[model samples]
Target: MQKLATFIRGDLVYDGSLVSDATLQERFQSSIDPEVVASPPLLGPKGIPQFRKLDFTRDPRLAGVQNPTLVLWGTEDKVNRPSGARSLQRRMPNCDVHLFSKTGHWVQWERADEFNAMVVAFLAEDSADALDFRRV
Candidate 1:
């Protein structure tokens, strides 16, 4: 992601709240936030069971994904790092990745225009009224 950001001349917002590190453990144990009614990790370790079940580092790239793929990544996303999106694009032959700044986990909702624009353009390219993408 760092290399890609440099190449694309874009920004990468890092969220310190990611649970990847020991810091998350401390945060989760503290229960400082009033929103958390229970003893942190509302869903427990099973909350992210599938992710825990996989060996993501050694996961193989997909096959027959020749169609254009659109990836909308949130810059401040804690669950899935921005680098994951870059890696996904690297494997896919035709993928357009738009990293929305100041957004965490929900890029589409955070930056609607950019997200709409990317998807619209991709869809419009296959349509006769490609120019009407802005209206979409």
Candidate 2:
């Protein structure tokens, strides 16, 4: 539990500069939910092996996706870099990428209003033609 809290309060916050104590507490609590505490999906011994087997870089399935896709990322994300989002944009047929500056893994939580607005706008769009990669 202490280890999980440390990882959530430190490694997940992207330099731990922008997050508040309240936000950290909330994140930590959510991470340790009773249902997920000892679940295989959690980042435990069982989950680590599954994650290690994933090879997104050489995956050909991403190029086959024909649906319109939105890839939202944080510029300061420590877990996954901005380049991963760019890679997804390149692979997906119709994809738009947005990078939030000064944000970490919890981009939606940190910028809820803007994230909600973007998601609403994306869903409201009449056509995929209206969507394009424009960093905001």
* Local accuracy by lDDT, each model: 0.60, 0.73
- Cα lDDT of model 1 by residue, 7-120, tens digit: 222232333233243533453445555666555453424446665545242245543467767888887776568797887777777877888877766566457688888888
Clashing pairs in 1: none
Judged by TM-score, which candidate is best? 2
Q: TM-score, each model? A: 0.51, 0.71
Best by lDDT: 2
Report the error of model 2 at residue 44, Å: 6.6
Model 2 over residues 1-136: C-alpha lDDT tens digits? Answer: 5575576556565556565667667767776789767673634235655665563634678889887788888888877777888888888888899999877777787777999999988887725444443422
Ten contiguous residues minimizing lDDT sum, candidate 2: 127-136
Number of backbone clashes in candidate 1: 0
lDDT of 2: 0.73
Alpha-carbon error at 5 in model 1, in Å? 31
| Model 2 C-alpha RMSD to native | 6.1
| Deviation in Å, model 2, residue 99 alpha carbon | 1.1
